[model samples]
Target: MEIHKKFAHSILLLFVVLATSQYSCQAQNSPQDYVDAHNAARAQVQVGPIAWDDNVAAFAQSYANQRIGDCNLVHSGNKQYGENIAWGTDLTGQAAVDMWVSEKPNYDYSSNSCVGGSQCLHYTQVVWRNSVRLGCASVQCSNGSWFVTCNYDPPGNYIDQRPY
Candidate 1:
């Protein structure tokens, strides 16, 4: 009976080991090691916390000894969805200018009310599309992305202290 119990325990351990092999199939590491590595990677601030100016500076430096202008470029983080890449930094705040240059329209505005204010939490009325309707964004941080709830003002340009 003792020998039989030992044999069953050994088989169980072997199965556990084999079941975890997929996580470390790329390299010859154990499942515990992979979990540790994953935890370490999660300790960093997600994408949105990155400074755009720093990124611009580094990118510029790579080309020349140039400095990224400190025009308060969007302090957004990197990610799969939200990345406030300055589509165009033109002096003239023309709506059409941005629309023309952007391949992705610079942003994807959500449909919301503007009477009084907007339901958007963190959007800025950057420019006027028509009159009251303006561009806004709600900044957020996610996995390697700076997500801002972007949108325009058609229902009335501005966010009132109300939920829509």
Candidate 2:
């Protein structure tokens, strides 16, 4: 009986450790988190890095806040800045940026287009060489999903211009 109890306690402790590790692996939604992820992705394509902008972030935050009720992936309709929006369960800033970067394989620099009608705007916007400012925000909605948005100054996805 004593050996059985010890084995059970060890198993429980192992499970707890594993659970905590998994939770901690999830990224947080911080401004720096967003910037770091974006910079890393941009570096891969030799594009210049972008700095955080308070005004841009404020705009992003306001837009993100507005979606707390529905967490919809709607644009703010502001033409002055380039934008990207994402919705998911417990989404983090870094995770959202990673999701955008994942589209890299679909983007063809020579053609300056996404392959086979696939979506690559988000990826292009991230590494847009001329987009020097970036602001982002993330909010957890009433329905428990997360909404994330990032805005870029001088937006990237132009009709005939390449992102890099």
Candidate 3:
């Protein structure tokens, strides 16, 4: 029984090692690979194996240099998402210009009527269209290729944000 248990533990450890190595190899993209991914995204292509831009110092430097005058780049870290690259420093603000990658138009406008400046029931209006590349919003990271969705508006109404 003791020998059997030891053998099982060794197999498990080997499997773990193999799995970790494979994942790391796949996740580590070369600097050129990062540039290619960024270019594809600039051309409105959503390629997979998204580069999350975690500890890629070289990639970050190259991306910043490449998009110098094209975007207002910002490096930000999220506790849950780890280190990430963002565009338009205040891209979360109301006046921020973002890219809407959805296929249709999406609208969100809401107002609450005030009587004598008193608080009233809150009312909200949310509208959207159903189509490919319509109602979705996306923002490219400073890393160049990765995109995060900003579903607040459609593609046409907001500023044309791009990676270039």
Candidate 4:
């Protein structure tokens, strides 16, 4: 009886773990997921939180949908919006945002530049004070990789301006 109870408990625990992992993975790609990830990073630097815009999301979704064939990392060329893009196998929207936020260490707020010329534009854009809106999209490509993108309004990363 004791052995049976222990086996049942183990099976239950494993089931719970698997269920939780699956749900989290599925939840990582929504618009709210993207906004929450971005806001969390922005909050760390005392920057104001941004809101979601349907128009912006539509634009992002359209661009992401277009890349379903090749999953290439190309800018939308809108110039009206700031953009950050990422591509990887099994990439999720939250994962892409996390990857961008990982560049925080490379950014120098005092110097207003990336240290050693490392790529920190994505990080800077996430925390840009004047960028009051955000939209993001994730699409699975024909090659089995994922493409993710986030667009910011009023843009960021001006030639001589500080992000915050």
TM-score per model over all chains? 0.18, 0.84, 0.25, 0.85
The full ranking of all candidates by TM-score, starting with the best, is 4, 2, 3, 1
lDDT of 1 by residue, 50-149 (tens): 1113333333223221113332335333221221222222211222223222322222345333334422222212222221222222211222222222
Regions of model 1 farther than 4 Å from truth:
1-101, 104-131, 155-164
lDDT of 3 by residue, 1-164 (tens): 99999999999999999998654433423433433433333344332223223333433444445445445444322222212233443243111112322211222222213245542111100111210121112233454333222211111112222211
Where is model 3 poorest over a 10-residue stretch in terms of lDDT? 122-131
Candidate 2 achieves a global lDDT of 0.89
Task: At residue 164, give the lDDT of candidate 3.
Answer: 15
Which of the two, 2 or 4, has more lDDT? Answer: 4
lDDT of 4 by residue, 15-91 (tens): 99999865665579887888899999999989999999888888999999999999999988989899999999868
- As a whole number from 0 to 100, the lDDT of residue 107 in candidate 2 is 93
What is the C-alpha local distance difference test score of each model?
A: 0.28, 0.89, 0.31, 0.91
Clashing pairs in 2: none
